[model samples]
Target: MGAWFTHLILQLAAILGSSLVTPTPLVRTDSGAQLERDWGQQVRLKHLYMEGNSRHLQINPDGHIDSSHAQNFYTLLEIKAVERGQVVIRGVNTDQYLCMDTEGNIFGSTTYREDDCNFNEEQLETFYNVYHSPRHKKVLSLSLEKRPYIPNRELPPLSMFLPRENELPMATYSRRSSERETNDTDPFGMRSGQQASPKLSRSSRG
Candidate 1:
């Protein structure tokens, strides 16, 4: 019985030690795979181009949203994931959050109001995706005539936008520090002194 108890004690200690060890956390790098990738990163939304009506979600310095011309500086925005299928849009240049009022007024504000700014981001069967204000049942559209306020049922072609990478995502434009903690232990997220495999990513289906 004493030998059995001793063996049981060692087994329990081994289990406890394993539990204390932290597993590698899944990281979303710039070259992250689809399943591994997540939002809360900066991206640009580009609408279908027309001669007079090229639209991009641009925030003015005074906390106003414009869908007119694609302003290089102001068109960069960040989509932060709040919960599944929900996100909040914020302007990278103006430091403002994109919001929609119940009266169908689309604007940007320095303050973030959860209800006003929470939007449902969904990818369509096609190449484009859409942002809809679920609370107000309004679609954030970029129509040439009346912008950012179409009924969700209408589903205008211009309302959908293609996600694009920021051309010049500099540290100067961001609030966060430029420093990313180096993984001295294992930059490849594994044990050291082994043959490095080719950088891998999961190809996402369209």
Candidate 2:
């Protein structure tokens, strides 16, 4: 009788142990209309020119998404509604989720293993959408241009969103620099005293 009782107790303990380790399934309500009103279908994130560039955000082959990539098949994503105002950004092509970690770097996740990947989709008063990760409460942005020739090890783990400029400084700078170089140097590789003008005179026009 004592051996049988011991065996029963062991079985109960094993059952309890299994229950402790088991993860509880997420229970969702049938709020179809509510979900539709809040979360739209799969969409591509286009960079707001007022906030940054006009490029579209896309996940690269290495499993990182940024604004440097143009709108394409791999860049398309779905925004799924979660608890509260939070949501998950999933890549339609790769079937991975856009999640952040404790260090505040964003990456693609195959599973919902960390809470950092879930973000709060806060609509700013400026009518722009900002994604805030719960881990560090920092907003994610894709404003940096990709340098493909650069080595991966030398690159930063995450790219930061640059603030919007009234005019494109890079483009303007390149143009002005080219003009100065042309004006300073002649085609024969000699220093010119006067600026070279491409416009022809009226007599020369004939």
- By lDDT, the best candidate is 1
Q: Give all TM-scores, in the order shown.
A: 0.56, 0.46
lDDT of 1 by residue, 1-206 (tens): 99999999999999999999999998766433223335533332322222225566677787666664554767876665665667777666566667776655567765555666788877656646677787776777645333343434447445676666666556655433123214633221222311333221122100
lDDT of each prediction vs. the true structure?
Answer: 0.57, 0.48
Q: Candidate 1 at residue 177, lDDT?
A: 18
What lDDT tens digits, residue by residue, belong to model 2 across residues 77-153?
55555555666666554655676654455666544433545776655444445566765555564433222212122
Given candidate 2, what's the lDDT at residue 113? 32
The local distance difference test score of model 1 is 0.57
> Which run of 10 residues does model 1 get worst, by summed lDDT?
197-206
Clashes of 2: 1
